[model samples]
Target: MRLLFSADGSSGDLIPMVLMAREFKQAGYDVCVCGSTEFEGMAVDFDVPYEAYPHSYSDIYLDNQKTGYIHNIRENIRHRERLFKGEFELLSKIAPDYDVLFNFLGEILVPSFAEAFNMANVKLFTFPVIPSERYGPPMGLPFVTENKWVNRLEWAAAVFSAKYLFSYNKTIDRMRGELGLAPSRNLLAENAQCDHMMIGLYEELVPPCPSWSSIDYSYIGPCIPSQPAELSDSLEQFLSQGSAPVYIGFGSMRHQNSDMLTRTLVEAARSAGVRTVLAQAGSTIGAEVEGSDDVYVLREYPIPHHKLFPRCLAAVHHGSWITTHLAARAGVPQLVLPQASDQYMWGEIIYKKELGPKWVDMNNLSQRKLRTALERLVAREAFTRHASEFAERVAGIDGAKNAVESFERVKSKLRR
Candidate 1:
């Protein structure tokens, strides 16, 4: 089968989808990954065919950062407005060439394209978000109470409000109209056109929502690929320098005050007396740490969290799903600084699991606070033991293979 996989959103969104594309290829399917031009190279690295779509993920990231993280209703609405303008006409143009479409957060636009081609499409999402009573409210919203009834009400309100709040009904209808289709009956039913929707995260991190079990969804775990080669000889030597360092990185989340954040991170590690290895995704952290022996800032092409996390005592990051799972699989505790989206959910998971530090808002982060968190994270023996146990469980699950099996089932049903 010819499989077309596409993704858009932040830069971190593309990495796991590329890994999944590789899995599809290995399963003897012809795979082509489409996304912002920035991910073309990633597709090539995975030996999958590449298809270019309009927009640059880095450019989108920088543009989104200008407005800051979605902290309020207005910010969330503004964010969706920006996304509505993203040109997905490319999907329409290429839709007929593929047998099946797999998209990551591409549902908002895919409905029109799927209707245009009458194709089988699946939505693959990484976030542990579903408007179910069993799972509480969606990720970004605060969990107000432990009462299941109250939590269920929050989910209902959030989902109900999203239909109007997104304010994209007319815009999407227009897109569908242009494709010679009727208007979408309910634009808020975001994944309505998808033949299936799978949450591509570890079940441990996000257990299945009990009420949604009979629906078309599955937790196939994080489809993490095999670890790439070690980054560099210098990095290896730096790891050998002292006690295991803290691995810090905020993948692709723009840091407007990168210099200060960089300095703060360095100082935090210094105060905690822990060495640091930082992946300055797009931050000025690497520049700030120049010539510092205690901190080695990696500004390389592709991050190898898989290879590096095992060498670290703890991982500190923006609570990106891939990063957190990588650290978890390595049996390393984390200090999660949540900025946006499902990051807060992962942070809560880490804290609840007793395997890492509590969530700290980036806006409120300080050298002293971070130092104290780091000290507490490392000093707690239960954290390491719990993390190690979790790691053992995670190591046994092959989510990529499981996803392929699920995809095959989808294909078989389509054949029927």
Candidate 2:
């Protein structure tokens, strides 16, 4: 069957979706990914069919940040509204007819598109997105409790943000009307939409929650990709020369104060008395290290996590699900600097799970805080032991293959 995956998010969302698409393609199903042109290179590298947005989302978001959307909630909210509306128009124009719509949480409007086209659809989540009776709201909601009433109230705030801040209901209804379909209501009501919900995360890391929604769930672990040969000879040499640097990279989350953030990271690593490999993952952060030994800035290419993490004493990054899991799988302790979204949750989990020092917010991140965190990150043997244990557990995970089996099960079960 042909599948259209609308995953117009950053690397955390796109990379996993690309890996999943690759698996479906390998399984003899027609698959295509729709997303930012910034990551078109990754899709092309993986040999997956890709549709690109004219401008890179990173560029667009950075431009928005330049206008001070980073601090103001109102402007930030409206900026996102415009961004999604633009995406909706693009998808409606360019998408091909497909049997299934594999939608990402970021492109929430794609499900309405799927409904309009009469396509079988599954919502994809790299982490726990569904609000549950046992847990609470997902995606970094500050409070989660055992009380059903309390959780529901917190979930109302999330739903309210979707409605007012992002205009999710208005957008979905608008699209549905254009397609001559029924309007959507109660946008995130449990099982309000979606034929199935597939979670691509490590089963061991995900906390068990009782079902609050009837959508068929496929916890097919994380779609961890094979590392590309992106590391240069000079980069490899730099890694071998150090007493294992603290590898720092905030995957895709942006900061308007890029210069200050970059300075803070460099200074902190230096203060911790460790070598550093600062990965400028599409951010305007660092200059390439020519012969500097204390810090080697990676500006040209993304540091391959699988290859580089094992060589690092610790990793300091935005704790996106894929990054968190990969760092864990590589037996490296981390200093999670959460910038936004579900990252805060991952940072907290990493800390409680004893994988790293406490997670600090990027806005509040400083040389002193990071220095202390890195000192703990590099010196603690307990972290190494826990991280190694986690590594062993993840070493055998084949999330792509398992995700394909989940697709089969969902397809077969739904047909019956």
**TM-score for each of the candidates:** 0.91, 0.90
Task: Give one digit per residue, the lDDT tens place, for model 1 in 145-182.
Answer: 33568767766665566556556666777777888888
Candidate 2 lDDT, tens digit per residue, 170-265? 866776788777775566663235788777777666755665346567777777767565577888899878688888887665667778777888
Off by over 4 Å in 2: 62-76, 93-96, 133-150, 164-168, 190-192, 227-230, 288-291
> Candidate 1: how many backbone clashes?
0
The positional error of residue 145 in candidate 2, measured at the CA in angstroms, is 7.0
Backbone clashes under 3 angstroms, per model: 0, 0
List per-prediction Cα lDDT, in the order shown: 0.72, 0.73
Clashing pairs in 2: none
Worst 10 residues of 2 by lDDT: 66-75
Clashing pairs in 1: none
